[model samples]
Target: MRLDASAGGPSGAGLPARLVWLCVALAAGVAAIALGTATWALAQSPGPAPTTVGLALVCAAVASIAITAGAAACVHRLARAHVRTKASASAGQPVAGQQVEVYVGLARRLQGLVHREIQLLDVLEAQVEDPDLLKGLFQVDHLATRIRRYAENLAVVGGAVPRRQWSRPLPLVEVLRSAIAEVEQYARVRVVPPVEGTVRGHAGADVVHLLAELVENATAFAPPHTEVTVRARRVALGVAVEVDDRGLGMPHPEQDRVNALLADPGRVDVGDLLRDGRIGAWVVSALARRHGITVKLQSNVYGGLQAVVILPTPLLGDRPPARPPATEPGRMPSRGEPTGTATASSSMAGASPSPVGARHHPPAPPALTRAASPATAPAFRDAVASGQAPRDAGAAGPLLPRRTRQAHLAAPLTRGGPGPVNQPAGDHDPTLMADFLRGASSGSGEPPAVRAVPRH
Candidate 1:
């Protein structure tokens, strides 16, 4: 496990022998000084015989040992003081980081509230169809998205997860446009033909944020009269998103620093953010590192910036045919684009109706309890007759929870269904469930009362 294993072996064994010689030289220096002092004392003595000279020599040796020990002690003390100073200086950094942490916590809390509001807005957008209202909601959504982005920067730097997930793979083009939408000058930006594909759900957030940062830099630094262009290409290792601008490119040193950070963003410390002039770059680098992505910044031919982001194969999903758009530089999809998905049944031709649909209708599940008209009652009747359990317990896959499948079956049937089933402890008899559905579906057994309780 040790790379220096050979350093302790035969080859390197004597490499440290010079240390022994150095110690010997130190000892000789001490002895020589002692001898000199002994000679001086012998010369100064009034009457020095052999015994007195020998006694002087002994005193000199003692003095030399004391002096050598004192020197070693002083060396150790100086070393200890230097170490303490360095440690103290390093300790102060965490105190400053703690202050930043307070703000980071506050920022994340605020982000959570804003994110909740964003979720509500998403629900509203889905439920409402009025164009005027949609436009206002759309703008509000954009504003919230920006707020969330800044919040995410704080959270990520503070070492926290941002908003909730996108739940499923998102259209790659849509995610790219969403990133562009957050830019200040989105209108001037153009997206060339992109590889029609989808991005994995969890990676969607990072990819979007990363692209947004690059696109923001492109549009923000570019000349006001020029447009920023986004392009994509399929590469051998992965897919690359390229943002091109005609603005002044970065100086060599800054580009190198940015590239270094992007190459290994773990080297970035949150405490160092204050000294950084480019928080956008920091965020991009950190997020890219988080997602195992590679981002490279290159100077374009026209002395502009080109940021190429390479995403690995795992992040890509359901890649359709590689085709360029008929219209180059296509704008983001407008509000007129349909929000709904077309189902196979909806697309089928020559559909004839029975009670609910064609002569053949899939039997309703056994769990539904909703009241039905006499014509529709037959489906429920068939359901009672069939008494079928869910075929694939988790047929919904990752989209919906297993418990929600029961709601998809039983709860929606009743006019005033037992809203959410508050099941009692240890009873899951399928027959009991079916009976309960039937009871809830049917009107009360008592006859209707004819009297009006109150006349205003």
Candidate 2:
């Protein structure tokens, strides 16, 4: 439920008026007490009968009560007037002929705000490279992006804009992969793969915005270094995308807050969590409602928040479209190889294939290293050979040149072993390696795929 300035509540802008009323009540009580004491003193001093003093005290008490009541009523009325004025001002603003216009304006403003906020964050990031600082910056950036996306989604819906038919079947895998890449820049986490193949649906920009908000919110509230898993699957009726995070689970208070916000979009205090100064959730909800998409928010099995967006099959129609055949040709039926030959082939595949003589010579270590061989060289080479590692994996060695490596090695290993490996190494389990490679290579490899339609 939204609670804005116009909302009739003690905690709103009328708080000041409430305080005034409270003060007035206190003063009246004090005055009544003083008057009673004076009346009692006068009667006891032989100036007036004790009964007169009592009567005077009663009158003073009645007067004080009446004054307090009047003051409260006056304060209430004043608060009501203040609220009405604010509401009138908002309503008096010219209403756009189309919701789309309003939405587009909101989106543009949000975009500017986000761009400015991100620029500010970049400066902050350069000033302090601490992990905590970086994490916070990422959180803020993610929030800003979410707000911008929500605004954009609203704009799309307000305009009754229909996305162009995808030129070809969408590479759902590629879309999700790109999203994961974008998310990784700020999230101190990894995204898990979906259980099924690419989800087919209406390819549009709204999909990206929906996924971004869900993933971002999950990351922001999740525990540090936890993984956020995204899964997409085709249900009998439509497509479902699930984003799961293993962070601080949603508590009743937060749930209540979100529910209240959804109920009353106007009451949202967007400034609290987002740097972009826009109400992200309200925009998201509005967009979702406009599109007839169903969004379910729930607690994840891993004790974190899970957001599921189910886009009805055909997304815009009733029947699922036929999927194209796979790109790769089917494998030929293989005759059983002799045991010895099979063993040799397996050995060859498992062994490092780089020519021995062609191996790159290890560069000399710096002053700090003294005698130690740069341990990371082998690992770095192995990572690169794996073929699907993130770009950083290939640049890891040179980025740390020999000198920097020595410095890193010399620094007291605060935690045993090297800093947590950001990406899996070549030696990681084959299944995991395959998944990572798939995600790295294609933008649509996971849930929350990229927009399949080309933007005009």
Predicted model with the maximum TM-score: 1
Cα deviation of 176 in candidate 2 (Å)? Answer: 2.3
How many clashes does the backbone of model 1 have? 6
Residue 341 lDDT, candidate 1, scale 0-100 = 18
For model 1, what is the error of residue 379's alpha carbon versus the real structure, in angstroms, after optimal superposition? Answer: 45
Best by lDDT: 1
**lDDT value, residue 72 of candidate 1:** 27
lDDT of 2 by residue, 52-157 (tens): 4344444444544343333323323332342344456578964334322433453344344434544544544454444643554454444434333433443453
Model 1 lDDT per residue over 1-456, tens place: 000000111111122323422442354344344344434544465452234434534543443333333222222222222233344567873233443454356456546655564655555466545565456556555555665555565566555665656543455676788789866577888889744555666777778878987888888788899989888765544468888899889887767767776787546442243233345665676678787789999898879989999876446542221222213323211111111212222112102121122112223322221122222233223323433112111211122212422333332242132432422111122233332332333223222121112122
- Which ranges of candidate 2 are over 4 A from the true structure? 1-154, 157-166, 181-191, 194-203, 256-278, 316-456
